[model samples]
Target chain A: GAGVSQSPSNKVTEKGKDVELRCDPISGHTALYWYRQRLGQGLEFLIYFQGNSAPDKSGLPSDRFSAERTGESVSTLTIQRTQQEDSAVYLCASSLGQGLSYEQYFGPGTRLTVT
Target chain B: AQSVTQLDSQVPVFEEAPVELRCNYSSSVSVYLFWYVQYPNQGLQLLLKYLSGSTLVKGINGFEAEFNKSQTSFHLRKPSVHISDTAEYFCAVISVSGGYQKVTFGIGTKLQVIP
Candidate 1:
């Protein structure tokens, strides 16, 4: 019954610091995804996890971005040495499966600001 | 690869007036189309999706979209809009022909419903 949820509704950090955004997907969901939304821009795919398979990291802009999901439950997105360009809203979504037909339910997102 | 294009960045329409949000996509293979709405300070919500079968798909809040394979388009429309309908609408596509189904989202359209 619960929807996706994310922690730290807002985060402010230094340019060289690292930040971790957490996401709690809906119960029984087997698919989870992370995206970045910059101001005045669209959602950019970051990574995704489906069950026990290897996560898709193709959309990661750099090596600093990494994510991990523990057995189809909670997921965490970590950004190392954050930059001003990485300042944006980090959103998480989950679905029943990896099927193209399944709909994704999104979380409120964590707004990260680098100063 | 798949990509989505939202022609208009913003659309201002009076309440109870018909409105359309244009969306076009390009993909090397067959794809699934979707529309998502985002309210202020909130995450995206699925408005509708076109997986297969009928070309005309209906969604929540009296919204609908027609999938045109020939023109590579999936435009969202509503007979009448409410002031509460003011939000950002996003068009997305996912290719079904391949290994990993990555969703590509458009820049989005900001719909400002004037009362």
Candidate 2:
């Protein structure tokens, strides 16, 4: 892909249900990131993946939030038993990851609405 | 730990008018700074970054940012803005070591360029 691609531009799911969001990073990019944005609010860091290394899951809000990446190409974010507060735009980004100056490229984002 | 703060929630400017969006951050060590813009229903796009060297950094869309280490700020500025500039601007900071350190984002400031 020419850019980072995300699945399901908009998702409307019932509360307590589970949803999985996918992110396909730019080709050969070694770093992938996930972020959450509430309505009219700041972005909250979720997780980050660097190649085949262990992902940094420090920002996952709870145990219900988890993510995985394979071969540093595609990643998936799963929110189990979603809550009302989980409704937000989930954004994925990728970067070269070699230097401190690598600027991330972002996807269109998946807007999730919990009802 | 790292965190970012965007003081203003909204800013309105007339077309061709100058504008500034303020951002601040806190980190224990030297960090890289960045500014990203999110247009309506789109993903975030990197506006600029200050990894090292000069404090001033130029970016696409006629946007620029000044990295102030003393003030712990990275403020985005434009000499003139267009109606198309209406969007949400976010400031971010990450560790200089890189590698999956989740970038912390500010709350974001909505730039409204009015005609």
Candidate 3:
């Protein structure tokens, strides 16, 4: 893809249900990132992946939230037991390199709603 | 550890008027600053970034920002805003190490340009 792409533009589920979000980053991008934006709130960092290196999960809110990336191409974020607080727009971004100065390209984001 | 603060939650201005969105950041180490804009039902797009060199950085749509090291602030400004410039603006900072590259975002400021 020419840019970062996210799946399932919107998802509605009951509380405590599990959900999965997918992200396909731009081709040749070595760094991928996940973020969450609650309604009228700032974006919260979730996780980051740099090529085959170990992913940094320090940003994950809890054990219920986990993410995985395969060979720097595609990634998936899973929420085991979703809560109302989990309702937000899940955003995915990819960068050409691993430096903080590198520019990031973002996806359209997936809106998740927990009723 | 880093944090960004956007003082104003919303700013309303008339078309052809100038506008400024204030952003402040706190970090123990050197970091890069960025500004992103999000339209309705869309993802974030990088407006500009300040890495090094001159303190003044110009970006798309005639937007520019200045990095003030003494004040720890990077405020975005536009000479004249158009109706199409209405959007949510976010300020972000990435750590110098870039290992995790955690981007801490501000609560965003909604810019409304009325004709």
Strongest candidate by DockQ: 1
User: Model 3 residue A53 lDDT?
Assistant: 79
Writing each residue's lDDT as its tens digit, candidate 3 over B25-45 gives 999988889999998877899
lDDT of 1 by residue, A10-71 (tens): 99999999999999999899889999999999999999888888888989999999999999
- TM-score on 0 to 1 scale for chain A of candidate 1: 0.97
Q: Alpha carbon lDDT of residue A71, candidate 3?
A: 96
Model 1 agreement with the true structure over B19-103: per-residue lDDT tens digits: 9999999998888899999988778999999998999999999999999999999999999999999999999997743456677
Off by over 4 Å in 3: none
DockQ metric, candidate 3: 0.77
Docking level for model 3: medium
DockQ of 1: 0.79
Would you list the clashing residue pairs of candidate 2? none
Worst 10 residues of 2 chain A by lDDT: A95-104
Stretches of model 2 off by over 4 angstroms after superposition: B97-100
Which predicted model would earn the best lDDT?
A: 1
DockQ values per model: 0.79, 0.78, 0.77
- Docking quality level of the chain pair in candidate 2: medium
Give the alpha carbon lDDT tens digit for every residue of B50-73 in model 2. Answer: 888989999999999999888999
**lDDT measured at residue A10 in model 2 versus the true structure, 0 to 100:** 90
